[model samples]
Target: MNIIQQKKDERTRVVYIHIPFCTNKCFYCDFNSYVLKDQPVMDYLRALDREMEMTVQAQPPGSISSIFVGGGTPTVLKPDEMQFFLNSVRKHFPDWDENIEFSMEANPGTTDLEKLSVMREGGVNRVSFGVQAFQNELLSGIGRIHNTDDVYRSLENARAAGFQNMSIDLMFGLPNQTVDMLSESVTKALELGLPHYSIYSLKVEENTLFHTMYQKNQLPLPDEEDELNMYLLLMNRMSEAGYRQYEISNFSKPGYESRHNMAYWLNEDYYGLGAGAHGYIGRQRHVNVKGVNPYIEAVNQGLPRLNTLDIPREEAMEDFLMVGLRVLDGISRARFEQQFGASMDQTFAAPLEKLVHAGLLDTTDEGYKLSSKGILFGNDVFGEFIGSLTGN
Candidate 1:
């Protein structure tokens, strides 16, 4: 089951393009990214173009429904740089759906009106700003470069650039983040009247500065009780404010869910381009080289792959349960049967029965979904299915 390679299936409808450069790295960040100073910005963009060309040639694309450009601070690209990068995207995967979700991650202060106009003109209709927190103290404590003002100004700039579909990300469980602080942040975020919000808890990942602080007992994270309270508070707040908790950490108004992210939660295949990007196609998943120069060099010769693993059926079936349950709609029984050629209940009867008996999962006419109780303890519910089939 380890590192098995498999053929790619048809219909990969998503695209995740990565830009691994930022002005400064956040303390809690562990994504494959680099500081932008002295970096080869243009060279990386050109390499990404080459990769796009090679990737589509290999798999061939159908009409793209979603294209997401993620960080480190994609908005940091200069106007000309942004234009060139967008040109490359259009040059390669040009068959876009009429209602395609062309989203880009932007930092607050980095996106001036000029740059945002370029992005809008370049076919980016949705822009998600990374406004991690509202408090200046909290922002600075987490190594964020923008202040509270930047969030407002950036959103204003985005709207002015003709973007009506917008989103913002906020973080909780940050160092010294009180529940009151989180409440205040939520109040301010809702005031903006944005369509979507992704509020996530902080996980101190390895290779992050926060991890070192945690090891030395210096990271002042909220206690588990407060963190839970914070989560409950936001869920209540968003629900009261007419936002649906469609996924564990995401809330959106009706008809405004992030379609690009839904592709991931639905466990669909996508094209991953650029440095350190990951792509899953057919039953195979591939990751590109991490370093900026290394990715460029690899793309010059061939697909910039660090490794491509073939997902075994048992693992893939388990994956079907793990990620699919994150959505409130849960995994579709018919979808599981369609993908694996077996009945969902018959295949995962043991774990399904256990979870349903525990009241963590409620059986639906269509399939199964997390109960109200289960949503809070989602990790526990998801864990039960890990080794149910293969016992590995």
Candidate 2:
């Protein structure tokens, strides 16, 4: 902690707000969200406002650099609800950076011109639509309500509403999905020439309909080779098309990277507001109550946090390595040293040496980054640092 380092530490905060209501939940999804029908929508918004007030009162906030509204499909909110929710955000966290990257996660078919117009006026400068895939069959099989037409209409509506910094999500591995199918999806996605794309392999997390089918050997997922090919194809395609693989699953044109996600990869402190949202600040992290009713009730009493934990220094170091490496540019040695007040070389010498020796990690003049091969086998590369210091 020298004077200059202290001066540099005054970085702005990132904000994540969760709206856990969806018109419908996709089968492969396990996010903390519920069906929108008959829910106490207005009550939840008010509860969210109260939670935000309490949160700022406790720790306060610096100028907000990014605000990402995610989950269940934030655009599912009606025009009026959207206005109130956005108003709550401005009321509590008014200090916005002039160039703040305010992003809202939208689902196709859930947004119309009117809804999007409300969002743009509410300080949202970016919108990411979850298109998942271009083919109608894959979308239907996955229980998504939106079709290819809906995706087009949604993007057109967003653009019509004065949005240019938009992004879309595409999925790779899924039941009965082929390499050709994925290739087709990629082709269609790139054709739009959007500023950003986030393509991910399916993980079939527990508690999802897909997970249940997997248990019964009913989930006909793509074979490993096909999945590998899909990943490789996307990497090559995005690169050739002039998009940077900013992070493992995300691609964007120069300067179009999602700043909110960058905050997570850098393991920086961010305010996570709303039900089931997670926030980390100063080595302490809190998860809000997951259920909408439970969250609203909790907020009426006080902060709606389900639990808060002080992240141990060793675990935090491991996390720093895990998340930072996801970025193509990798982590910085100076950052590690400044945050932990220790040399990265001395802290995890053996693991670093091992990974670099295996060609999974490469040493940069400033720090370390994943090698070209390391990108494909990222899970394995990250695994090496999981317990570098702590036995677990």
Candidate 3:
């Protein structure tokens, strides 16, 4: 690449750390993970530290705005281990923004007051708990290790640990979940009065136990109508609870939106490290080796890169729109024009016009956003962007 292109790429400032260990894999989970019993936890952390060193060596960045350590279950680490991991991060990425949002995903069953205290001391300002459901039976049915009590306790511990900016995740349309159950989960989560919520409809992914049961017709998930009711109910309830529906599945109490996730939706550059982590710097997109041993060995050698691709401008613009429109505010026309040097209207004329005609999209004063109808069919709207970009 030329000097000008390289200079533009230097704006990369976000960092993602992956901790690929869980107590036990959930039935619906398909993320890179392994059972935590007898795993080399310390060794993995050292490997991650090495990976971070290699990453900065490859491309030294300016001040980082955010760092998200996602899992397996990050809270699985002991208090001291958590401290070591976070400290290693600060040591490597020393020029972090003062207001940097350092978030870590925690599972309810394992996150305790002591561990959270250590995390707080280590500069973890935000916590996202994976409380998939509020009902114990449903939680067990879905292979979640934590119960409702665990969820409450985890939230309390997080709050006591000085985490005011917190987010809880809930899943709907589970094997035996109904609209009423979904509402109950939302109601319980709202009662906690956290800053943000992410309620997702369960999708049966391949290689997961859920997919196996689904293929055998053993799973009794909510029908399309019931799932639709669940979505509508949660939206209304969240709105009444004074939370804004910022994204299709995410809600936040004013100004509590996730800056790290927003970086992805805004289509900005970021650094990704650890096993199975993905990074996008400039036009090149890359994923580290998904296997833990392979990642450790590769990083020790030089870098842990698995595969890389250079995305075309048209494809990148479509990805930007697809992710940005998931937010209620939607993408900006001026930003799109500036990034791609092409007007959004002129570039995506046919699909935008067709979707708006079908009442699936509404044009705001500044740009286009998904209509209420479009949300239920968000995948379809995003599908248009992808198809239009690749001519598929």
Candidate 4:
């Protein structure tokens, strides 16, 4: 069925806007993004505006609980461009929940006071800075143009612009990064006293410079043991600092958890707009056209959807288990029955029993959750559920 002609579901409460332009690409990064130089920025924004108009008219969202503008570097947009883009959003998603969490991803060097002021006035309440590491050498080593000073300056500017609910992304296990270096970075991050922090281990995905370097034995990533140690050390540090490990890689002060991301972890439907974005609605998941010009041209006629697939009930059940287990609280048994119309235990007794016997999973009153030992070996636990239902 044509995606546009398909019946619209009003369950979507989260909106994700993807800005595909970046100042430069990082070596270890593989997200869908383009360098900003000589690109048709305004045309892309117009395309996005058209997509928003067509989308809400088709499906009209439920009261939007959260709006996340992520990307190549959302803050890289000029102030006027930001205004136009934000105005387009306000036009379509006029009614929002009282406590809407509007967040935008920014790079340290790209956000200045004026651009931040534009964001603030446009109703962006949260700012997430991509401050990958605090060390200048490591920053350069990872192909980041921003330095330590830019991180400090960006935070100061964000605060001056009246953003309190802010988060900074930190990465560990980089090339030539040491435990002490990571410790220092964590100390500096904690000292900021921000509401949220996301520290992720580096993954060398295909098509990235890091992957090519890895293939050539040129990337100097930490060994498996050191990487594991790094993860353990950060988990302990964040706990000691009074931050809750709400998800495996996310820590937050009480009540400051990222609601938009939580919607994702809970496997809820959301609107994904802009080039190369993915969306889930009803039972179908869709990916938008990837290339900039192609996406813009496609949306000019209709939706820019490149492909759509209806997720089978078993696959959705597997996805629910895999994604929900990322949260510390785990999935709820009642919610699973409500969503899939089957008992969780009845659906996959074999995998659940195996995981429980291996001490990788434990039962809660609400449902089953990952055990303390299971947290470190999460992929193994999630793997147990995949293909277990269909025996494929």
Candidate 5:
């Protein structure tokens, strides 16, 4: 089916609302976020509401199946302000799926009982906390605002506020992180008995403190072998604790997988609102203006704040391969064939053949998935699809 036909007949509708305010930026973060302490917060909220209206008006779909409010730290907004923001969303979108997954990203220090309760009342049911490590010194070393106490308190507050569905983010392969420390973090996380967890390896991106430190030879990151060991340890521990590795960085108990994230992995179309947020719909992609003011002004003037491009069919097929391979289930050859009316072998002949020969990618009963080695060097395999026209 064509992009427009695919979207018009899509089984699920999702929305991603970006909240770009943070009290301070984390040293390792390169996401589109800002520490605009004195910026007009209320005005930004109003602009966000207007943006939501515009998007819905342009592409009204059926009831949304998932809604995610990701950050700069969505919990930074005060309780009343959060209510207003969420209320605007509900007013614009008539209904959400009964099992709608509404998730919000929160930092430990910025959330409290009252704030979480406001979010709960506003229809946010899932909380993902950015708890990088268990050690206070390491937390500070990474420029995290909250201490260990705040982590526990945030979980307590979430539970108290009736948020039973929750997830905690932990990082491995940090500047001085040890396997034992990773074990401790996992132990503590399990003790809380959360339904989901996202454990990611540290990646130093451009314009971040971590990148600067690396350039200066000041970063004391663990050796490659150690980082690999950390990954193995986390995988074993999580599996032993009964959490399934649904995606590369995500683990969850049965029935707790993140619907919003699954939408992306499945290559479904969704609307993304706010500065620097990205949207993919009707087989076209767009990224909003990165700065706060530019986005707000563009929204007010009825102009597209976005740089838009129609996704090439070959490119879309390649993206389907790249992202879908990240899931444990791998990409479905049948679905790919159905979507593009092209054979996978004819499309990704070179990369797939090279990878299969190297034993880094193996064809499975379901489709093609990463071999153990492929998982280690997934970036290289993904790179092969980046500019391939046949695969798109």
Candidate 6:
């Protein structure tokens, strides 16, 4: 069956809106974003509003449990622009869960008290700041426009604006990052006493400045041993600071886990709107047009989709294993059977046994999960589940 027919009755519970404009692009980043210069900003917002309006008319949503406005720095929008965008969201997806988690990604230097007030009044309850490092040299090296002072000032303003539920992102494997440098960054992040933190290793993705530097040996990144030590140090420190490692790279204090991101790791269906956004519904995945003008024009005509394809059963099973295993609690056997109508052991017995014997996966009462050792080599463990089902 085609994607539309299959997903016609599916009720999307999570909504992700992309605002693909940033103050400046980071060196190691490769997401679909453009500099906030000479672009038709209001025109893009109007195009997004039209997309949301048409989306709900086609496949109406249930009580939305989570709404995440991620970006190229969503806070780059002016107060009035933010107001218009949020109003459009409320106009379409009006029915929200009582305890909905509304989150927007902000850059350290972009957010201010006035814009934050607009966000809070518009129903945003959570704000995540992209404060990649606390060191000024590291910040400049990464091509980030914000410095350490902006980080402190932004957090202060966020708190002043009544935003208590906040999180900050940090990076570990940078060009000149060492174990001690990561420790200092972690110390500063914990000192803020926020509810959640997301620290990720820097990957030199293609088409980025960092990738080109790496190819020429200009990027003086930490070696494998140093990077491993850095990861271990941060993990130990976060645990010591009383944060739960709910996912591989996310830590939260008790009830502050990001529900919007958890929805993705749990493989739930969500609406992805705006230019260059991707959405998954029923058993199909689709990506919207990447170019801003092209997307706006397309949505004016109809849905601004570039391509949509149905995910095959085998590929879906592999995805379930791959994404589900990223969570600390791991995949559940009963839920797997409910989703695919087959026993987990029956489908993946060979690889499961292999990983179990290798001490990479431990069998739980409900299902299987990564061992402490397995978390470090997660790619290898996830790879075991990929082609094994087809072989059997």
Q: How would you encode candidate 3's per-residue C-alpha lDDT over 1-392 as one tens digit per residue?
A: 99975774466789988999999999999999988888888988999998888788888877888999998898899989999998999889888788899999999978889999999999899999999888899989989888888888888888899999899999888888888888888888888889899998899999999899999999998899998899999999999999999899999998889899999988988998889999998878999899877877887888888999999887898898899899889888998987888899988999999999999999998899999999889999988888687775
- Pitting candidate 1 against candidate 3, the one with the higher TM-score is 1
Residues forming the 10-long window of minimal summed lDDT in candidate 3: 4-13
Which residue pairs overlap in candidate 6's backbone?
none
Distance (Å) between predicted and true CA of 270, model 4?
Answer: 0.2
Candidate 2 positional error at 390, Å = 1.8
What is the lDDT for 350 in model 5? 85
Q: TM-score of each candidate?
A: 0.97, 0.97, 0.96, 0.97, 0.95, 0.96
lDDT of 4 by residue, 1-392 (tens): 65553433245789999999999999998999999999999999999999999998888887789999998999899999999999999999988889999999999989999999999999999999999888999999999999999999999999999999999999988999988889999999999999999999898899999999999999888888988888999999999999999998999999999999999989899999999999988878999998899999999889999998999999999999999999999989998998899999989898899999999999999999989899999999999988877666
The Cα error of candidate 1 at residue 358, in Å, is 1.2
Worst 10 residues of 4 by lDDT: 2-11
- What tens-digit string does per-residue lDDT give for candidate 1 at 35-96? 99999999999999989999988988878899999979898899999999999999998888
Which candidate, 4 or 6, would have the higher TM-score against the true structure? 4
lDDT of 5 by residue, 86-205 (tens): 999898876777888899999998898999999999899999999989999889889898998999999999999999999999999998899899999999989989999999999999
Alpha-carbon runs more than 4 Å astray in model 3: 1-10
State, as a TM-score between 0 and 1, how close model 6 is to the true structure. 0.96
Global lDDT scores for all candidate models:
0.93, 0.92, 0.89, 0.93, 0.88, 0.91
Error of 5 at 187 (Å): 1.5
Candidate 4 C-alpha error for residue 287, in Å = 0.3
Winner on TM-score (5 vs 6): 6
- Candidate 3's TM-score reads 0.96
lDDT of 2 by residue, 119-185 (tens): 9999999999999998899999999988999999999999999999999999999888898888899
Q: Give the TM-score of candidate 2.
A: 0.97
Stretches of candidate 4 exceeding 4 Å from the true structure: 1-10
Ranking by lDDT: 1, 4, 2, 6, 3, 5
